[model samples]
Target chain A: MTERISFRSAQKKALDIARTRLLVGGALLAAAFLVIGVRLVDVTLFSENGPSRQANARNIAVEKKMDRADIVDRNGILLATGLKTASLYGDPSIIIDPKVAARALVGVLPELSEADVLQKLSSKGEFVWLKRHITPRQKYEVNRLGIPGFEFDEEERRVYPLGRLAVHAIGFTGDDNKGLAGIENSFNTALSERSERVTLSIDVRVQQILRRELAAQIKKFKALGGSGVILDVHTGEVLSLVSLPDFDPHTIKQASRSEKLKEEFKNQQFNRTTLGVYELGSVFKIFNHAIALETGVANMASNYDARKPIRSHGFTISDFHAENRWLTVPEIFMHSSNIGSAKMALDIGVAAQRKFLTDLGLMRRSSIELSEQQQAIFPAPWTELSAMTIAYGHGIAVTPLHAAAAVAAVINGGILYPTTLIRRDELPANGKRVISAQTSADMRKLLRLVVENGTGRNAEAPGYLVGGKTGTAEKPTAGGYKRKALISSFIGAFPMNAPRYVVMAQLDEPKGIKESYGYATGGWTAAPVVSQVISQAAPLLGIAPVDETAPNARRASAIKVATPRARGQGIATN
Target chain B: MKRPATLIIFGLAVFAGAMLFGVAFEVSNLEDRLTGLNKEITRDRDAIHVLRAEWSYLNQPERLDGLSQRHLELRPLEGRQFSDIAALPMRPNRVPTPTTDPVSAETAPAIAALVNAEPGGLPSAETPIATALTAKPKLKPAAPRRPARNVRLASQRISPEATTSTAASDKAALDAALRAIFGNTASNREGASR
Candidate 1:
């Protein structure tokens, strides 16, 4: 095929060859792209392969979604966490021989019976969990069995490593990883939906202190139960809140329902400080003085005719330690005078008294970190007599926390807060206002007087200007107030000139101790407990123990009283 | 004929070079993914380490005991041990102590060669050692309750393990030494529970 070539013809032939080469290259590129398109379609539509997530296409399920956050203390201590645990789950329907698989599984899991395993494996269901919350070791043992149908389902298990220490605040979760109680249940959304830890106000060290003290008191007094709490005056932050009869949140089985947990709650079972509400006794006198002082019904020099009890509705209101003489405002508080308090409330008028209580957050249920809370019981119909009775902490039943909040507002510059459970930043949450600042000052004076000369005298702690009122409310049963059943409690603040902290200690049905001079009233038993608590806590809380001889301390000790005629008229009317 | 051969070799060499470069790029991309995975593991490990440290901090028994002792003068209640606050009579009013600060009067004991002879001569004002000891109790009323007990539990006998200054030094040293020898355990994670 060699043809003799002329110069012009040879050049034209070369150009034609170049054009053919370009056509070939374009055809090859189109064919290659077509092949790739066909393959992509085969994998997307026709393939029987596996899950859609391309990275894990060989696996049965999509990349197992694992999204959970942790709960830690402000100090970075892990309180609650969702840890990824290897759980033993299986494809039941895919098992080739149920009996063989069961035998193999039983060998690995000693707890499982061969018969039981076979029944579960042979079941018509496509999915079954062999064991939940399996350990890494167990997963390894089971995997070695080489059961084709068995597989692992990535699962999240909630763990509270601190157990019962901070259970009420950290809370526990259910199998489906839902919040059940405490912060776990209350702010489940923030804990689960968000990735940040929920830091509670509870200090682990302070909690330990409160728990240990309560436990000791319960044992010493032969009390069936006990509870304790510590609150910051300015912020209303709860440093420590303990309820005896606690349940370990780690193992759900140990903490059955409240019915079971109640039995376990014995000495340390129920959290009496916040959750349990009682008809607290003389402690209510603080509320009455606050109301009186706020309404301008009395001054520090005013006197109340506390010589006789005020009898009404066949019920007598009198001091536990009767002071059968005229008592100045400070004297009435120092003596925990129920009779004097009645007169003071009467002077303030029934409407004003009710308004004061409403302002103190007593008329509602507590809004704390834990969901478990009870509303304080108050008289259904607000009456003049009810006003007088409630003033002395009768005709109304509130939680120890209710007593704590009212006392806190009375001394913390009259700003009332919904006692908190979670630890917050230096700046406190905005709180609701319930009383005036001047009244708070007067209440502080009255509280200090009580510690120095009243029923709370036993509660005085050297150096820490201690002040508070003691409550020993007799439990009202079918046959009037029972002599045996008593709600014994004390609420106190230190450095009363400018208060810092509030500590409330209560012993449920505390029995008389020999050293207590055979008296189980709030003054003898619970007040002394506070003294010990103050002595130990003041230094750690960073309060400088000032000498009582100081003029500032002496000047602040005055307590205002609602004069005598107000008391005489109140008594005669009742 | 020789020129045509040269042209064919040139074409072959260029095609081979391009293929080799493409393969190398693919290998390097795969390696990059692996390195990214290792970095993620390290981040997770660091997070775990921090959480573990926090857990230990919260559970430290000495801290809890100190707080408890201060608030209630209450000891940790074992099942067998329980004492009431009311069991003790109004803590008998303490008799006034006559002393200056006790620390200077009874100088600290030499432990671990921490103390040395004072360079300055002694007395400015004469204060009795007994008075100084008395003053000491008032300064740290809570310390006497169980200072010894805390010392025992903290380090099984506190050696002043590592405070602010030492802790930083120790951590840095350990981190540097480990990083030098191990290349990054996260990068070559060849074991479980490692």
Candidate 2:
């Protein structure tokens, strides 16, 4: 009986131990499951910091940058842009049958010589460029050949949409897309770093008009070359700048290979508007008269004896069409009397004339956004003769661009703003006031009278209220002036009531034509060009024509003559 | 009962785990699709950019001008063809009168024939409209020309002396017509600003 009780007790104790151990195992398994559930929730809902996600965001940010920016005109016309092109390259070491590959490439690109391609393909190099910037069509043609060793490298090529139309302004890029000239050269850094389009102030329509008119006149005159400029008088923005014999930037590099073509290419690449300096003849009288009136040296009523040629320092100063008579200030300007201008300059004296010309920005290189700017050729020793000659635009040589800017300042309320090819969103704050308001107004009236009754009569576009001056200077040779080789130019502004643009057209060495009655003067050669350009461009620019009979038109164009006797009599009447 | 309860909880946990895994796989598949679509979009954008550049190049002004000169009968707009609406003369006062005579209306057909026959040439005033109408019915059949002739006459009556108008007045008329076509709100605003 004692043995049975002990065995039962031992069995109960063993059962109790087994129950405790089972409970502990169940608790441990429950805790493990709960921990796994918590971990899943944390991973799905709470974890935001992952190294892979950050890497993805960083990669996207790095891919958005472009290699170059586009260049567009003021009206959002695309002038210069970059396009993705495929360039063919060959791995010489891996190329199977280099002759077959060269022959295939030559078939796709006819411009590529077989000898050159074969040499490149057979060279002992890992890689060599066969052609750079091939057209998509060429790339497709090449790909269709199934040349095993040849590969295409994607690149960007700068293209000018208008070709040679604004080639000098938009310029061209080198093999590696580096700007070589014009606004491209000037704003290379800005263009290379940004994808935003650079807008210039060039109106392509106006550029076409200017180029067409200048080219027609240049061809007609059989001249060496010509340059023209149309500037916004108020903003100093160059609307149109045309230098004749301009080259196509696309083919310039290829054309530069031939000796004769190379010479022509060099000539065509010369930006004459800002680079070539010439003695711009009676056009200087506009400034001369303006200076006299501004300095109180001469007034509208001031009379000068222009009855004979003024001989000073063994140099005879005579008008092209000599008016041997005493002339009023208005008459002197109307007839373009060189003697009277010299007399006026003598009265103003050399010091004042130099100061005025310097203030007008004629003594230094014009501040335009161009790399090819030449300083005006002025006489070194300021002599009385030099002042007299400069008065008639003889001793001073200035570029067409400089003349355009200076004239703009004179007519645009006498504020000289730096000329720019880029579009200006706001008026510049640093425009230098060079002359008084009264002088600018008087100058406007005088310019109108010259276009109306004087030598620039042909420059009038019926309702345009054209106002201008004629400049016919003889080109200087080794010893003296070449009378036949004349640099005839016309500087004009329109809607004289409120001038907005100043246009200057020059013909180099224009021969006398029969239609012009054997006269190759500014009025005959260049004035008509200005008239055509103004007539065509005014409508494009949305300038309204004014009725000549209107009181406002009369009031704006009317010049007050202090002397009543000089009013009815013609300036040329002796 | 406790053993069955444990089995049910374990089964539920396994099912939840399976659903979570399926959702994660689906999300991963959508993300991969999004990346592929983004790449395609970027490639398409690049192609569009290239196409726009080519379009500009092909639409160069000189090339268009050449093409027009060779294939189209159009010219650059002239300044003389433009004028301000204010410069136009006042319209003449008139009262409408319907003519019952078909002969008078027949003159319109002749004029229309003359206009079509000579595209750019103006009808000569020396050839009387009445005489020309009586002489030229053979150019086209006169059956279907009555209503067209009446409509032409009504348009012509608005400007009877249009052909004889001076260049300046013609320019002014064109200007007024353009202003009527394109509203004068811009000019009115300009005037207001001034």
Candidate 3:
């Protein structure tokens, strides 16, 4: 009985030890599980910078960035955009038959030479680029060839959808996607760094209209080239700027590199609207008239003796169609009298004229968003002869853009706003008042008179109430002026009661056409172009035609020129 | 009791581990799906970029102008074709009687032909109405024509000629004829048709 009791005690002691060890193991396991659960929750729910979130953030950063931003017109029409394309590359090592692969690629991409591609595919290097910027269709065609060694590297290409339409404005990019000219060059950093589109103030519709009309005129007149600009007068926004003989951006690199096309390529790349400064003849009279009235040196009734040519400093200033009689202020402008304008300029003097021209932004390079702008060539000496010739648009060379912007200021209630190719949500608040409202009003009347009964009659777009001045400059040679090679141009504003837009059309060396009565003058060549542009563009611009026959309309635009008293009949009658 | 508790705690630990493993597997599957979706989105975005460029190229003004010249009879809008709503004479309550009316016979058949010619009915209906209202005609159309044509005539109300009586009578007859055809729904049709 004693031996049995001792055996039971030993068994009990072993059970107690095993039970205690089991409880300890369970508690340790629970603690480990709790720690793991807490760690999981902390990593997932509580952690501020989780691995998954970090990966997502990195992916978002990659997705948001682009090589270049798109360029769009004011109407959000795509002008220039970046297209991600695939470039075909060959693995020379893996290519089974280089000849067959190259032949296949040549068939798909005809522009690629078979021999060159064969050489590349058969080369020692492991990789070779066959073509860059392959279209999706081309990539698909290449894939269908079942070439084992061919692959594509993703790349971004700058594409101008409108081709050559706005090339000078939108510019072109190089193979490295770097801008080389025009707006692309000017806003390179902005375009490269930002993903947002750049919206320019160009209207593609109006640009087409201007381009079509200008090209038609250029073809008809047998002119060397042409440039045209249409600017919103009130806001100083360029609606359309066109320089003809513009080249397609795609061919620019090839054209530039070609030895035979070097001169032609440079000529085509020239942005004439802002860069070519010419002695834009009678168009300067618009400024001359405005300056005369603003400085209180002349008025609508003021007269200048235009009977004889004014000879100064071995130069004789005479009108093309000379009115050999003493003329009234309005008569001189109506006839585009050079002698009268020269005399008026002498009266206004040099300092006032320079300051006025500077204020009108004509003396300096235009502040337009272009790198092609040239400073106006004004005489540094400020001689009497210079003032006289500059008055009639001689001795001073300014770009067509300068003349357009100045005219915009003259008609847009005398406020000179810096011309811009960028759209603004509001009218710029920084416009400087250059003339009184009354003087601007009177200038509008005088301008209308020119279109109504004077030299710019061809510029009239019946009910649009077009008003303008015509300029015809003889291209100056090394020795003297080349009378036959004329730069014919017209600067005009429409809806003259409240001018909304300023249109300038210029033709380089336009020959006389049969329809223009064989007169290769501004009124004959460029004025009709402006008339057609206004008639077509006015409707597109949402400008309504007024009843020009209304007494109020007729009377408002009318400027009475005092009759010349029958050539000194006042004394004769007395 | 201690033995059962120990087994239960070990069982709970295994259950939690199994659940954690299943959730981790599911989370990895979800992450893979997210990556796939992101790749698909990127591919779609690239395609859209290409399509947008092509769309812009096809809609170039010069190309559209050429296409329109070839395929459509419409010309660019002219300045004379626009006028203010205020410039339009007041709408006459009555339709004018057929007097000096050669245009309705011509315009009615022409309009009906246009309506039949067009696949979409409403645009054709509005185009003729706009042309008739804006184009000032010296001769008035018959009573069967729309009343808006009469409004164009009534704008000549300022004229001092004695022909006002005939015009006034014609307007009244036309209004009655229109009311007879459209009934009270004439107003509703007029508004809805435009």
Ranking by TM-score: 3, 2, 1
Estimated TM-score for each candidate:
0.71, 0.80, 0.81
A108-157 in candidate 1: lDDT tens per residue?
88887788788889888888888888888989988898879999987788
How does candidate 1 score on lDDT? 0.69
lDDT of 2 by residue, A1-574 (tens): 7899899899899999999999999999989999999987887678767646865784584366567888898888888888788998999989999898898888889999999999988999889998888888988888899878889999988888888888777877888888888888877889997666789989888898888888898888888888899999889898988888898877867865889998988889888898899999999999999899999999988888787898978889998877787788988898899999999999999999999899988888777777878998998898999999999899899999999889988888888888888888888887999999889988888988988888999899866788899999999889889989999999999878789999999999998888888899998999999999998899888886655545566665687644335444444453
Q: Put down candidate 3 lDDT per residue, A90-199, tens digits, no spaces.
A: 99999999999888889989999999999998899899988888888999999999989999999999999999888888889999899898889888989998766789
Model 2 pairs whose backbones collide: none
Candidate closest to the true structure, highest DockQ: 3
RMSD of each: 13.3, 11.0, 8.8
* Candidate 1 fraction of reference contacts recovered: 0.05
Report the C-alpha displacement of residue A331, candidate 3, in angstroms. 1.7
How much does candidate 1 score in TM-score? 0.71
**Ten contiguous residues with the weakest lDDT in model 2 chain A:** A561-570
Candidate closer to the true structure by TM-score (higher is better), 1 or 2: 2
Restricting to chain A, the TM-score for each candidate equals: 0.83, 0.89, 0.90
Local error of candidate 1 at residue A213 (angstroms): 0.7
Evaluated on the second chain alone, the candidates' TM-scores are: 0.27, 0.49, 0.49
